[model samples]
Target: MQPGKILVAEQDGAFVIKLVGEVRLTLCTTMDDFFDDMLTSKGFASVVIDLVDATNIDSTTLGLLAKLAIKAKQRFSYVPVILSTNPDITRVLDSMGFDRVFCIRQEPVVDDEDLNELPVLPDSEDAVRAKVLEAHRVLMGMNDSNRAKFRELVTLLEGQCY
Candidate 1:
């Protein structure tokens, strides 16, 4: 699998984020920061996550995406869109209950010319751990299946923080 890189663009209050290659925990901090900024930005209207080129996306990244969708719906009253063409990735998203939080589409995003790669932000081990834990907690809150799936991992992560 190719290494993952995140690309982003914003126009007229619509934000587009394209994930390329194998997206994993290494990019979680960057993803989290971008989500925070995007959610708070003035004129924020909608967010569309493009995953057509994403070869793989780990649970951490999926959790962060879930976090984005949940926050957007709560604050903006609209579900975010997720563009994903790969069936395997789509299956993963379905299994994780993403369909509840995001409007999943098996199509490509239009007008991607202005998209720019987002730089990976460096984070300390503790900060990364906390983000990972928080992400899983959000995922766990989504559904019973997800709660069961991530409970043990969340417990382990929480224990390690002490």
Candidate 2:
């Protein structure tokens, strides 16, 4: 698979994030930071995550997406939209209980000419580990299956002191 890249664009407080190629834990820090800024930014309205070009999205990435959706709903009473076209990716999202948090769509986003690739931000090793752990915890809170699936991983991450 190709290396992962995150593209973003904002128009009138509505933000669009497009994930391309293989998305994994490596991009979690960047994604986490962006989510924080976007959610707290002035006039924050809505968010749309485009996954049509994403060939593979790892569990960690999914966890971060879950965190984004959960926070958006809790803080702003807003439910983000996720555009996913691939059957494989759609199945993964469904299994992760994303339908409960996000408005899942199977179509492409229009007016994406302004989308720009987000620069990958540098993060300390400890920061990355913490983000990963926090992300899994968010996923675990989403549903019983996620709790069961990520229990061991979260436990392991918690035990580490990096």
lDDT of 1: 0.94
Give the C-alpha miss distance for residue 64 in model 2, angstroms.
1.0
- Per-model TM-score, in order, reads 0.97, 0.97
- The TM-score of candidate 2 is 0.97
* lDDT of candidate 2 over 32-72, digit per residue (tens): 99999999999999999999999999888999999999999
Q: Over the stretch 1-162, how does candidate 1's per-residue lDDT look in tens digits?
A: 799999999988998999999998999999999999999999999999999999999888989999999999999998999999999999999999999999999999766788999999999998999999999999999899999999999999999887
Which 10 residues in a row give candidate 1 its minimum summed lDDT? 107-116
Clashes of each: 0, 0
Give me the displacement of residue 113 in model 1, in angstroms: 2.7
Stretches of candidate 1 off by over 4 Å are: none
